[model samples]
Target: MTNENRFNFNDALLTALFGTPSRKNTIDRLGIVCPVFPDEELRKSAVILCERIKKMDDFSWTALCKMAK
Candidate 1:
């Protein structure tokens, strides 16, 4: 698939998983600034970040929770 097409698909998947793109949610989830992209790109980046977050260890989760609070 083309790069644009792949990006769109990834974006759609992220929106389906995370609702809308917002700094609040990203910060809450201990994500980076990449999710601040425009709607399409934001969604795609969010999905990628989500996958990475899922692989984080307990220490990472604890830090995220603390930061979120």
Candidate 2:
């Protein structure tokens, strides 16, 4: 939970620090690369969402990514 808001979005270290993103970030980047994600208006704060995503195990996180698409 360090203040990494300014950290480079393209840095290899982003995954290392924040852990793998849940179904959100990559899906956002997907727009036309894939379909819309499941929830577009859940409206959770980014800080809270990132913390929850980080707590997920690797397998669960991967599953979410696939299901998102």
Candidate 3:
């Protein structure tokens, strides 16, 4: 029902295409420089997280995080 976006998609694309704003621009903007976790690292971390999360009561491997809106 609400957005939790950190950066606008257009701004992100501009940042990717042109890099960060120049000092003359003098305005704050959000952008992606690099992934926080690369593919291998993300896979490993997800494994660990899933292992821990499975210890919770009444959790199921096939369970959906949320139903479709």
Best model number under lDDT:
1
TM-score of each: 0.37, 0.36, 0.28
CA lDDT, every model vs. true structure: 0.50, 0.41, 0.31
Lowest-lDDT window of 10 residues in candidate 2? 6-15
lDDT of 1 by residue, 1-69 (tens): 445223344444443444333434543553544457567756556656566555656565446444444
Clashes of each: 1, 0, 0
In model 1, pairs of residues that clash are 11-44
Ranked by TM-score, top first = 1, 2, 3
- Stretches of candidate 3 exceeding 4 Å from the true structure: 1-38, 59-69
Best by TM-score: 1
Local accuracy of candidate 3 as per-residue lDDT tens digits, 3-28: 53323343234334433223112112
Query: For model 2, how does the per-residue alpha-carbon lDDT over 15-36 read when each residue is reduced to its tens digit?
Result: 3333335445533433332233
- Among residues 3 or more apart in sequence or in different chains, the pairs in candidate 3 whose N, CA or C atoms overlap within 3 Å are none
Pick the winner on lDDT between candidates 1 and 3. Answer: 1
